[model samples]
Target chain A: MKSPLQYRILPLGDHALCIELGEIIDASINQQCIALFHQLKELAIPFIKDIIPAYASVTVVYDVAAIRKEHPSAYGFMKEKLEAMLLRIDTDQPLSHRKIEIPVCYDLSLGIDLQEMSQEKNIAVEEIIRIHTNKTYRVFMIGFLPGFAYMGSVDESIITARRAQPRTTVAAGSVGIAGEQTGIYPLDSPGGWNIIGQTPLKLFDAKRKQPVLLEAGDEIQFVAIDINEFNNYNLG
Target chain B: MSIQVIKQGIADSIQDNGRYGCQHLGINPNGVMDPVAAAAANLLVGNDLNEAVIEMHFPASVFLFKEQSMIAICGADLLAMINDVFVPVNTPIIIEKNCVLQFKKPLSGARAYLAVKGGFELQPWLGSFSTNTKAAAGGFEGRNLKKHDELNFRTVQKYGTALKNKDCEILNWKASVKNFYPASPVIRITRGSEFDWLTEDAKKRLQSDSFIISNQSDRMGYRMKGDALIIQNENQLISTGITKGTIQLLPDGQFIILMADHQTTGGYPKIAHVISADIPALAQMNAGEKIQFKLIEQQEAEDLLFEQQQQLLQLQNAISFPLLKFKQQYAID
Candidate 1:
C-alpha cells in the first residue's frame, strides 16, 4: 500500500480553502487530490458551494454566512470539520476512471503548429501524431475558460513550450499542447498553446445537465480522423 | 411590460448573482462587478437580492420604457434622466409608459446597475442569468445589449397598476450610497498562498507603491501598472482554482486582479486577494485610477465582510420599515 499523503490546508480568503497535496505534479499526488475531492464531495458538507480538484491541490468553496449560521465562527468551523474529514480520506482507494474518446483531425491545415513543432523537435509530423494518439491522458483540471479541460503528460519527445506570442483568437474545439500538457479550448478565446489538431465535439454546452465534457480524474484518448471524417462528423 | 434599447452604450449586459457551483466546470462567475450596488438596487425596487439587473459601463445605455414600471439605478452616478428630468439613484422611481430614459456622461464610478421591479425576463444558464459572452450563452441571447434589443419585465404589470401615475414618480426615501465609496484609494488585501514566493523588495513594494489601473482592464481582470514585483525564486505554479479579487503576479512582474468574470482557475502565482468588503470599492475604480494595498489579517478581513453584510441587512430593514408602515396605514396589498 502507498504511504499516506500529507497536505497543507490554506485559506484562499474568507470564503474558500485550498488543500495543497504537493508542490509537484505527479500522477500519484493528483490521484490523492482526486480522492480527497471525492471524499469531501461524498460527505455532502453543508454550505459547500464547489470543490475544484487541480493538478496538486483541491479548492473547497463554501458559503461563509451559511457556515456561520451553523457554527459561531465560519473559518473555525470549516477548519475543524475539514481537518476531521482529511483523516478519513482513503488515499489508496482506486479511483473509478471515466474513459472518453476524442476524435481529432490532425490534417496539416487543421494542425496549425504541427510543422513548427516538427522542425523544433526534429521529429516527423506523422510521428508526432502517432505518439500523441497512442497515450491515454488524464484530466488534471478543467479551467482557464468554461469547460476547458487541462489534460496531460504528453510524450516528452513531443513536448513543446507555449507560443511566444499568443494568438488573438483560438477557435473553439482547437486541440493544443503546452509544455507537458494538452487541452482543448471549449470556447473561442485568445490562447498561447501550440495548436496540434481540432475536435468537432462541443466540449461545453450550457444547456446540458453536465456542461463540461471532461471532469477531473477522467481518462481521455485521442482518435485520429481524416479531414473528410472531421468535416462529416455530426456536431449534435 | 417591455423596454426597448434605444442606444446601447459601451458594453451593457444583463447579470445576476452569477452562476454558482459551476467553477469546477471552468465557468467564471460572470455577474455584476459591484455586488453590493446590485443587491442594493434590487432591494430598493423591492426585488430579491439576486434578481437580474442591467450592468452598464460609462456613457450608459438609453432605454425607452414601453410600459409603466419601477426601476432602481445603483452603483455609478451616470446622471440618469427620464424625459429630460434628473432621476435620483439608490431610490425607487416609477416611470410612465413611453418615457425615454437616458444616462449621460458618468459623474462618478465606472459601472451602473439598473434593476427593475420583478427583475428581467431572461432564462438562467447554468443556474444564473449572467451573460458569459465568451461562451456565447445566457442573457439577452448571450451578447451585450444592442440598439433596438427589447427586454420584457417579469412583474411590471403588477407594479404598473399598483403605482400608476401620469408622470414619473420618485420614492420618498433612498438608501445611503456613501458607504459604498472608498474613503481612500488604499484597498485591504490578505496575503495569498504564494505571498512568500516574492522577493522582500517585491513584498515591500506591494505595500508602498501605488499602482494605476491600466486601460486593458475589464470585467475579467484589472491589470495594474506599477513597480515590477520580482519573485526571489523561479517557480512554476501549478494551475489552481482562483476566485474574484485574486491578485495574481504575472510573469512580467506586474499584477492583475481577477474580477467578476475572471477565469475559474489560473497558473500565475497569486500574491494576494482583495478583501470581500472592499471589492465594491475596487469595482468602482475606473481606468488610470491609482490604488494602494494595505495588508490585513484574516480575522480582520472576516470582520470587515461581516460588518458589510450587517450594514446591508440594516439598510434592508430600514427600507422595509417605512414600506411596512405605509402598507398597514393604506391597507394595500
Candidate 2:
C-alpha cells in the first residue's frame, strides 16, 4: 500500500495532458513518475501517442482523431482513464533499475570548463572530479537530445548553475552540470550546461543494435579514466 | 522510377506524418513541417497520407525523373515548373522519362512537399521515414536529399492510361487548401502551464501584439520578436515535458515556439501552446513573416482538429476512388 499522491492534470495542447505529481525534482517523486510511466505503457491505450515522464510529471500525448471517435472530449476521457488507473497503481515498491558504468576523462584539454569551474568554486580540479564520480546518480529523464540522459543529485559541494552565456556548439560526449543535475551531450548542439569533462564512448549511435546507451530510470555511475584510456575506449 | 537530385537547394529532406513513441528518449518527430500539404500531396499521387515525401525549400532541388512517374507538389507555392512550363500546386501530374522538374521562385509560403506514387524505397528508422538530421538517422541515409542521389521506387510502375503529352500531363482535378492555409492568418494559442507566471500587462501584449518570425528559426523551434514579455516571477523552472507548438518565454524576453524537432523536455517557462489545428499554417509561415496569437478555449481547439481530420478523410475518399477506378481500367499489372 502507498499513500495517495496529490497531482494536477494540466492541458498541453488539445491532444495531450500532463499529470504533474510534484513541483520539484526529487528521487521519490521521480520514482513515482517512472512507476506511472510503466503503468501507462502497460495499459497500451490505442489513442495514446507518447507517454513522456519527466522529473515530477508524466505527460500523456494522445491521438485526437482516434479519441474523438469514442469520446467527445479527448483530454477528458484520457484524464478519466488515467485517474482510474492511478487508484490501482502502487508506487511504494522500489523502481526497477539498470546500472550503467560510463568512463569519463576529466583532462583540462577536453573539459573546457574544468579549470574555470574549479577556480570559480574554489575546489581543486581533482576534488571536483572526485565529487562528481563519488556517487551513483539516478536517471530522471532522457531528453533535450536523443540519448542525452538527465541524471540527478550531483554532490552538493559542486552544485553549479548553467552558464549564463551558452556555448554556440558543445561537442558530443561532453559531460555537463546544471544546478543539481548532470548529463552527457549525445550530439553536438548549442547548450548552456557547464561542461566538466568529456567521454569517448558514443552516447548515441543510430547504426548500433541498441541506439541509445542509457535510458530513463537507469542507475548511472561515472568512472574517472585518463585521456589515454578514453582514447582506447573509443578505439575498442 | 527514381529521382536524381540535380540541384540540392538549401536543406531539403524527406519527411512523413511524424516519428512518435520516442520522445521519452529525447528523439524528436522530424516530419514534414506542413502536414496538410504533405498529406494532400501524398493523396493526390494515390499514396497514403503519411507516406514519405520529399520536403523541399527554395531554391529547391532540381530532380530528373529516371522514368515516367506521377507526382504532386503541395505547400508553399514555389512556382514549380516542369522544364519551361509552369506547374500549379495540389494537382497530380505525370512526367515523361528524363524530364527535369524544378522550382524557379517563391510565389507564396515557404516549404514545399513533393510526394511520388507507390512511395520511395527506403528503410524506416525507428518506424519512420522522417529524417533526424541531428541524430543522422532515417530518410535517405539519415540525411537530406543531395545532388546525384537517386530515390528508387518502392514498387514498379504500372499505370494503365497513356499520357497525351510527351514532357508532362497535368491531372484535371486539384486539392483546395483554403481551409488549411489562409493569407494573413491569425494563429490560435492556449495558455501554457506557466501562463499565470506572466505579468498581467505581458499577458495582454501576447494576444494584442504582432510578432515577427526571426531569421534564427528552424524546424526545431521558431524564435519570434515583438513585445518583450515580462514575467512577475524570476524563478528557475525545473525541466519538464514539452510538446510541439509549446511557446516558451526566453530569458531575453522574446518567445520561441517549439516545433516538430523540439526537445522532449525543457526548463524554460512555457507561456502558451499553439493550437494543433493551426500548426499546419504555422509550419508554412516563413522567416521574416508576421504572426499574431488569438487565445481560445481547449474545447474549440479540439473541435477544430476533429473537423480537420474529418475533412482529410473526405479528401482521401475523393482522391482514391477515382484513382482506384483509373487503375482498374488501365493497370496492366
**Cα distance off (Å), candidate 2, residue B27:** 0.7
lDDT for each residue of candidate 2 in B26-62, tens digit (9 for 90 to 100): 8888898888999999989888899999998888999
Q: List DockQ, one per candidate, in order.
A: 0.73, 0.84
Alpha carbon lDDT at B11, candidate 2: 82
Using DockQ as the measure, the top candidate is 2
Docking class of 1: medium
- What C-alpha RMSD separates each model from the true structure? 1.8, 1.5
Return the lDDT, model 1, position B94: 80
* TM-scores for every predicted model: 0.96, 0.97
Please give the distance, in angstroms, between residue A177's alpha carbon in candidate 2 and its true position after superposition: 1.8
Model 2: per-residue Cα lDDT over A61-118, one tens digit each: 8999888988899988889988888888876667668998988999998888989999
Across A72-150, the per-residue lDDT of candidate 1 in tens digits comes to 6677778888888887778779989899999999998989999999998899999999999999999988888888888
Tell how far residue A32 is off in model 1, in angstroms.
Answer: 1.5
User: Candidate 2 — which pairs collide?
Assistant: B160-B330
What TM-score between 0 and 1 does chain B of candidate 1 receive? 0.95
